[model samples]
Structure formats: C-alpha cells, structure tokens
Target: MNIARPLLALLVSATLLPDAVAGSFSFGLWGDMPYEKNNDAQTTAAVIRSIDRSDVAFSIFDGDIKDGSSACTDEVFSRTAKTFNAMKAPMVYVPGDNEWTDCHRKNNGGWNNLERLDTLRKLMFADGRSFGRRKLTLEHQDAPFVENTRFHKGGIVFSQVNVAGSNNNRVLDEKECSTKSARSAADCEADNAEYAARNAAVNRWIEESFAQARQRKAKGLVLTLQADPGFDLPETEELDEAKTRGWNRPESGYKDLMDTVIRETRAFDGQVLFVHGDTHVFKLDKPLHAPLDLLPNFTRLQTFGSPNNHWVHVTVNTRRPEVFTVRPVMIKAD
Candidate 1:
C-alpha cells in the first residue's frame, strides 16, 4: 500500500481529544546508531534495556541508524527497527541521511534511495499504532513526507516533524547512473518532472504541519529531525559554507519547516523544543536566533550519536500552559 494512503487512513480514523492532559510524560531520545566499531546489536540492546528501566513515556531515536555512509540492506534496516521497537515504551524515529541519502553506495545495497525511503515508510510508520490509540499520520496527505505527527497527551499537544540532516539527496548508485545515461531524452525529462512533483509535495507537507499546530493551539511544539541546525555561525568559513549550501542550508525545506513551527508557536505563547543528532555530540544548547520573547521556552536536545549512543528523558507538565524539561542520560557501557 502507498505510504500516504495508510497514513491518511490512520489519521482519519484517529480520535482526537481536545481536553487531554499533558501530565508527567517521560521518553528517551538519542541518535546515530550502529556505527562501525561502537554500534553492535548487543550494545544497542543494552542501551534499550537501560531506557526501559528509566520509566519514560516513550523513546525517540533522533536519526543516523548507521554510519553516515554505509550499505543499508533490508536485513540491517529491519534488525535496527526491531531493536528500536523492543524499547519498553513507544518509540518514534526521524530519518537520517545515513539511513537514506548516504545509503546509495554499492556496499549499501546500491538501491534507489527513494525506494529505500519508501521501504522505511512502509516498515516504520505505515500504521499509526506506534503513537498510541489516537491515530496520527504524517503532515502531507498525498506523500510519505510527514511534516509532523501530533497527539494530545496530558492536555498538551506533542508534535514531531520529519526533517533529516541531508536534503533527501544522495549520490546515485551505479544502476541509477547507468540507467539515466541509457534513458531516452523524453524519459529523462519525465523523471525530472516527477522529481519536481515529489519535492513540491514534501514542501507543502512541511508548511501544513506548522499551520496545523497553530490551529490546534498546541501548548508546546516538539520539533524533531536528524540534522542539527547550525547554532554557531562565525566558526570556520568552510563549515559556514557547508552550512549555507546544500541540505545544510538554513532556508532549505527542513529549516523552513522549523521556522514555520517556531513562528506559529509564538502566537500561542507556547514552547518550542528542537531535537536532533548529526554531529554525534550529546549536548543541549539554545540556537542563536531562538525567539525567547515570543516563545520563551526553547531547547535543543542532541543526544549521544557516536562514542556513546545515549537517550534523552523529557518531562512534560500540561497545565493551562505546558512545561517541558529535558535531561540527557547516557547508556553506561556494560
């Protein structure tokens, strides 16, 4: 089944509770898993066991299920998903470049990155059950591109967006390269048109997610993605250039999605919490341009991704307004 259709079905059937209370909900958040040396199944399992014992509401795996660039076969991806599913609490995942964009290498199965993405949609988010009884789907109705997944918990709206580090662009595999070369001129043009259509759909989904958050009067917005938005601007010119261009560019689709959420949440007098993992550093630092006055509550929780794959514990208290407190907990090596 198409990803959007299942998502739509789930969303349409989901029950919405306006008076839901966002009491004390705890969840684990982490990123960048299965690195070459540090991320074995045993290590991943131990991390999950720790989270289960922590008594979290749910767990959110930030991204990077594998090294930045590696072959991601069905078996590998499935195993990783299973490991996450094994968490004691419900788990949500945002895509990372490693799982999709960087998986174009021959060793990485050399499959169409888009196709792998579709597979992910089918496996990880095809059904809305992961989010609990209330049905939730991606923001976009026609595409698997989900801007945010929203649910009411303890009277507060908890929302998540699907923004990854890489702009869903990866180097083409040999087959894709060769096929493009052998394709007729008309076929190439047609392919370009399709690409444009998909890109537009993704952009629309992003815009709609923020719009919905505003309409829903969300007390606090939890925006989760894979890449870390550049918090430091005047560091190195090379790094600055990389941040300014390509997928890392601030105004790109992902940034636009976040900016919309940040701006819209301001009108509701809510908090904006951003979570991501790309630099493999576990730290919490507010962005340089966070709108503190409009949205006084803001946090960037990027948990362990490399040396130590850790998870974040977030506590949400839903009173008239909502409060979000985050604590990063590392998975002790056994």
Candidate 2:
C-alpha cells in the first residue's frame, strides 16, 4: 500500500506496454505447406530457419500446416506444433480445411471430419496460447477456442479467425450435403448445423474486434483468416448479378464475413489490413464490389503457401500514413 512502491510498479508496467515495446514491429506469415513428402522435409527446414532468423516480433502461419492429401493424425498436429516451436519468435496458427473440414475426402484417409476438427482444437489449442518456443499472451474471443485470438502491437489490433477456404467448410446445396463427402446424410446435416452456428460466431467475432479497435482508437486493424474469400471473382458471377446465388465460386459462405469487414472498415477512420492464406499464392491488392467498391483504405494480402512455400514479412506502423508494408520472402530451398 506504500505510495513509492505503487508508483514504481506503475512505471514498470508503463515501460512494458506492448505497443511501446513493439514499435514498428514485423511478423512472418506462411501456410499450406509441407506437401510432397519427398521434399517437404527440406522445404520445411529452410522456411523454419528463415523465420527464426528474420527477427520479427512473431509469426502467424495463416493455416494448412500440412498437405490436403496427408492424414489428419495426431502426428500431423504434434509435428506441426514442434515445427512452430522451432521458431525463435512466437508463432500463431489457425485451422485450415485440410486439417479437418476436408479430411473426409477419400484421399485424406476419410476420417470423420468433425471429429478430426475436435481433435485438432484439442491438440493445437488446448493450452489457449500461441505456439513457438517464445510464446505471448493472447486474448481468445471464446475461452479455449484458439481460433479467435486478439493481440495488439504498434497501436494496431491484430486478430486471427478460423475462417478457411473450401467454402469456409460450409455445406451448400443438397448435392454437397448428400453425396459430396464420405459421411452419411445425417452427418452432413450435423455439419451444416455447425457451419451455420460457427459462421455466425465468426461474423460476430469480427465485428467485435473492429468495435474494440475503434473503442481503443487503434490506428489500424489487421484481420488474419485462412481463406481468400475470392474477392476477385469475375464481374459476371451470378452472385454479383443479384437475384441469384453463386454456386460456382467460394463466395456464398463468406458473404457474412465480407459484409462485416466492409461495414466495420468503412465506419472506422483508419486503415484496414486483411491477411489470408488459402489459395497458396502471394497477392496484395484492393479488391471489392460496389457500395464499397475497391476500398482505398483496405488492403487484402494473400500469403505464400504450398509449392511456393515462402513467408511474408509484414511491418506495421500506426504512425505512418500507410499502416502496413508486406513483402514476400521466398525461402532458399537448396
């Protein structure tokens, strides 16, 4: 209760504030990797070494720590966790469809995808902390649900969501619900229910993250997801035509998320950085449709994954007019 002791504690806490300690921090992003078992060992080793040497604040592997064709076994999760732990910086990972949603595919061992997902959550996230030898405290949107996490750095709010590609794991149309998977109709129906509820939860979490950013007057907000959401779809898409549903592209399940992103980004007075990895290509641009067409203040960055098997170095600076600068660093495989 002594005044001197309390003042000294306050001074120590102020000095350790995340933003001040993280001024102009950088991070690495990678995903959809370790495919082609023959060469993945070398590639994975090289990429991990690169990240460990990059001297970034931390790294976020957007998703897909393994190939689609691999078995979603306990080994996969544990090995990936070990790989993350090898990084000198803290590592953050979200789920990819390959890890669970699409595990029912015959090529992927035809496991019960839902059960796979449950196991994944338990293995990678049960501790409710980020991966890597160096770990950081994270705020999970829902306790024990590591998919939704929030952290702050350089006055920007950085959040990760478990929204992945393959239509965000949604079961659309009777065809998909009935014959598209190894599971039975009843299993598909149950999956559809999960999709509905989880999608709603993801949308709410996104909105809440934006709200928190605004409340804190963060200079910008960075949202990391595992799906590209296909914002670059052709103008002739049925979804854009109105009065029709677009079944050709992966946009249906992402409409809610896209709407929330557009709405909150528009309302906020600062920049918005959207990062995703599904699609396994590195792309950076502004792509959107009307009413919020091509948001100048919004930037969409797709990270390197799979065959490319690289990582992105992202620098965040809230004091600058441009909130982010992202660069692709292709790891040397030799």
Candidate 3:
C-alpha cells in the first residue's frame, strides 16, 4: 500500500471514532412492565417502537419482564427474549426477582427459584452477544455469572450486574422464607448460598469495572441493575408499608456491594451513574446517605416501572461534568 493512501485512511478512521464524532451518545432504559393485570403488552410494544425510532447506542431492560404475580413459565422468558431480539438496538437485560427469586410463589408455578434462574441465564444470555438486530459483543463472567456483563462505549465503562430485589434473595426468617409457595427451609438455605456466591461475583465485577475505567481513562462509568437498594426506607416498618425494607432498612443484603460502590465512586475521578429499577418509581437524585454527607459525583437514575408504560432516554456527554442526563418518554396507549 502507498504511504499516502494509508495515512489518509488512518485520518478517516480517527474522525469516525464513536466518541470523536460527537462526544456524546444515548441509551434507553426500562423495566418492570407488561404486567398481566395492566394490559401492558400494547404499551410495551409502543415503547419499543419509540425506542427504535430514536437514535441510541443500545437499550437496557433493567429487569422484571412481567409482573410479580405472573407465572414464571418458560414461555414468559422465551417470549420476552424474542421481543428483545426484535429490537433495532441491542438489549442488555439484568435479572429481576419476579422472573427468578420470587418464582417460588404458588401462583408462579412453584419453580425452584435457583433452577428458574439457571433457565433464564441459558435462555437470555447464552452467547457473548447482546439481543437485537444490531448485536454488540459483551464481556461476561464465567459460568453462572454469565449474565453479568461489561462493555465500553462513548469513552465510558458500562456494566450490568445480576443484583435484584427480594433482599437480593437473602431470606431473613422462617415466615419470610417459607410462608409463600413451595419453598422449604432447605430451599431457603440453598437460595441464600446461591445469593452469597453471586453477590461475591457482583462485587468482583464492580471492582473490575472500576479498574477498567481507570486503565482506559474513561470519562465516566455506569452501573445498571434491577434493585432499588432501599435507600429511602424508614427505620421501622409501618402498618401501611406493603413491602419489606430489604436492602437498607431493617436488613441489608446489599451492604457489601454498597460499600464497594461507594468506595470506588469516591476514588474515581470521573462522574459515576447508578441506574436501577424494581421500585416502580421514576426518580433521579443523589441518594447516597453514607459518610454523613452525600457523594457529589454520584448520581442515581430510576427508570419508569409498571403502570408507567414509559422508558428513560439517557444521554451521556463527555463534555459535561455530570456526564449523564435522563428524560422519561411516555408510551401512549395503542
């Protein structure tokens, strides 16, 4: 090849680099939808259509393909996978309690929660590529942690960990663990064992993400999962409180993970974004209450969940100190 021609090609490639083109990119986020009682199929489809119409690098379905009350049948996962595969952009999914941990409920077909989780992993995360017509290669942890994924885009490190609600699957008591469905003390014990192993893997993934961010000198980092982590729960349970304060109030399955994130975020020089669902709330705030003062560089984004029929449009701009901006896109009834 001629030297002049080679130099010209290098220049063109440099100009076409993803971050160099605009210094910004966008992604979509949504979860806890298509609830059976809410007739959410049409709305969910509309939201997918809206995402396809927009220009985003990829979309993350944070978790909860169906409502908590729905059965965790094979068809549920298969249908959801098919839907995700049809999207124009890659869809990266995190695990949700409704699909796995809570599958032990009698109404949910009395699935062995861990077994259901294995089925989900094989069905949704069998390969290294993400779901969609335009696939993106992702780095996954070995074996059971295959769903934990990390990728880089627009000069930022992005990761998805399998952390979920239901106290991250740590059953607290006999009543809390065995009252529902076909679960026994043995099953609860097994569940907690699985939780411990996976929790360790999650922590490793977080550390690895931060290390990669530093090595790459990325402008920002994003951690996406499916649990709210109960940052705002009251100290004591009230009569009106329908849900248990699993992650941060009376008990905390997420203490180790939370500690890791806080430490790494504090150490990192760039902005940090934490995105989660499972609370069915739309919120954006700096909600970390540790160290007596909140972390100024850390931001939390909660996507629109069930009965909301909406998706969050997130834009990451390396030029901005905050790095991430979120907007909710409402899906109209079809």
Candidate 4:
C-alpha cells in the first residue's frame, strides 16, 4: 500500500471539505484594544474572560496588542502571547501598525520599524498552528511573509494578511518620518522600501487566497486583516466625485489591495466578508466600490476597538444565503 501518497492526498482533501459536512459554527472577532492606559489591562482581561466563557469554536484578533504610544518591547509581545495561549478557543491574531510599523515613533521606543516588524513576526507567528488551547493548522506564506496565512473552517476559506494601519506603513514624507522618530532620510527610504516589498507579498496572498477558495469550491470566504482600507472612497473608480477625491494619494497603501479585493470578490461566486479593526467604531456593511454601488456579495465587518473593549460573535453556515451573521458580544462592566 502506498501509505505516503494516500496520506498526502488525505491531507490535501481535508482542506477542501465541503461546508455541508459540518454544522454551523461561530467565532469571535476583536482588535485595536488593550491600550496601556484607562485601566485597560483589567478591561482586556474581562474581554478575554468573556470570550473564554463563550461557545465560539475559535477567535480572530484583527490586530493591535498594544496602543501606538506604548513601547514595542519583547516583553509586551511575550506577555500578549502568554495571554493568547491561555484562551480556551483557538486565537488567530493579525499584526497591527501600533505593534510594528508605528514603533518607529519615539514614544514607541524609537525602534527601527522593520526590525520591530521582524520581531513581532517571530514572536507571534512562530509556527503553523494558532494560539490557545485548541489549534488550527494554517498554510503560511513564504518567508518574511509567514504572518499571511490561509485556513479553513466550516467549509469557509479564511485568510489573514500582514496588512496594518498607518497607511500600511508607507512613509510618504522623509521630513514627517524624521519628525516622528529619530530616523534619517535614508531610514525613511528604507521604510518605504519595506512597505513596497510587504505590499507585494500581501497582494499575492490576497490573490492566491481567492484562487484557493475557488479551487476548493468554498461556500464563502473571509478576508481578515488590520487596516480599515478606507472603504468610504470609491477605491475602484478614478472619479472626480467628492466621495473619492483623495483615492489616489501616495500614502494610500490600501488602494492596490482594495483593487485586488474588488476584482477577486466579483469573480468568486461565494459570499465574501472583509473583516478589519482599524478606526474601530464597530461597523458592518457593504461599503465596497461606493455607497450606492455596493458589491452585492461582499460585506464588511469592523470589530469593536479600545475603551469599547467588546467582541463580535460571527456565525457561519453554508445553508444561509448570507453565509455569515455577526452580533456584538458586550462584556459587562464590573
């Protein structure tokens, strides 16, 4: 018997298992929280406890383990990892700008932004499995982009890209970079180069994820990341309209990703949900293309952020037309 080949085949087939094979399941979503002020540690602990007590199969943290002004020290990452590992449900965390890209700020310890990003990648995405007691096998991208991953749950394809806020860390001005941190003009140039490289990797990941979903005939696809992506603007249009005036700025790092998303979502025959946490405010809508010209199959869910220290419970069922339903899970105040 060719056990090795059969075993490989079985593992490959598992990724394509149909949603009908399993019943509906729910997961938790949250991010941009637990700042170093306002009694945040207690508040975040309460939020974690609330999640632990929930019946969700897994949880997705969109990003920001700490606030922008805090130090991006190794201790912060280690402590956060410890907390995540303690969770009952498997936790999928995306990197946030506050943790790495904006670490170049003096208040954030004036670290080299790229070095901070590498450190975060090493500490958090140290393996192919998720955090928490339960684990999920994730297919990670190539080196330096391992944080980008694709996993399957309930017949839905889920992708987490290494995209963050702060204009996706594209330093538009050398002067601005120097003023914010102690970086020289060369440092700003290097930062922009880093952004360019990561942006390319992210674009490839987004495209490949959609391709995988289509190949596996997934019921729906959920794209999770940390940036807001500025859906208010007509990201797909070259319009002179008031709603899309600043859509082509150099610092707008999300435009390319947005373009790829609109294209891929239009091509896929499944329900597509874009989840992010930057800019907080707990929003759920179809803000793609434009306000009036929204993508019918696409939906956007922004999880609750700081001070608001709550989470969103998302239920995915292949039998439903929408495929995903979301509700806010509020943590009771002590």
What ranking emerges by TM-score with the best candidate at the front?
A: 3, 4, 2, 1
Q: Which stretches in model 4 have alpha-carbon errors above 4 Å? A: 1-19, 233-250
Question: What local distance difference test score does each model get?
Answer: 0.60, 0.79, 0.87, 0.86
Q: 325 in model 3: Cα distance from truth in Å? A: 1.5
Measured on C-alpha atoms, candidate 4 has an lDDT of: 0.86
Shift in Å, residue 175, candidate 3: 1.2
Q: Could you report the Cα RMSD, in angstroms, for every candidate shown?
A: 10.6, 5.7, 4.9, 7.1
Q: What's model 1's lDDT at 264?
A: 58
Residue 95 lDDT in candidate 3: 86
Model 1 CA lDDT for position 214: 63
User: What would the per-residue lDDT of candidate 3 be over residues 1-334, giving only the tens digit for each residue?
Assistant: 5799989999998778777346798999989988998888888889999999998889998999988887899999899988999999998888888999899998888889999999999998989999999999999998979999999998899999999888899888889886767898999999889999999999999999999999888889999999878666455645222244334345678877887998999889888989999888899988765436778989988889878889999998998888888889878966
Cα lDDT of candidate 3 equals 0.87
Candidate 2 backbone overlaps, count: 0
lDDT for residue 56 in candidate 1, whole number 0-100: 75
Best by TM-score: 3
| lDDT (Cα, tens digit) per residue for candidate 4, span 148-243 | 988987778999998898888887875777876967788888988988998999999999999989998888999999988776654455674434
lDDT of 2 by residue, 166-256 (tens): 7877776767754645777777787777788788888888898889889888888889989877656555645652223232245477778
Which of 1 and 4 is ahead in TM-score?
4
Question: Candidate 4: deviation at residue 137, Å?
Answer: 1.2
Better of 1 and 2 by lDDT: 2
Which lDDT value does model 2 have at 59?
Answer: 88
Q: Is candidate 2 or candidate 4 better by TM-score?
A: 4
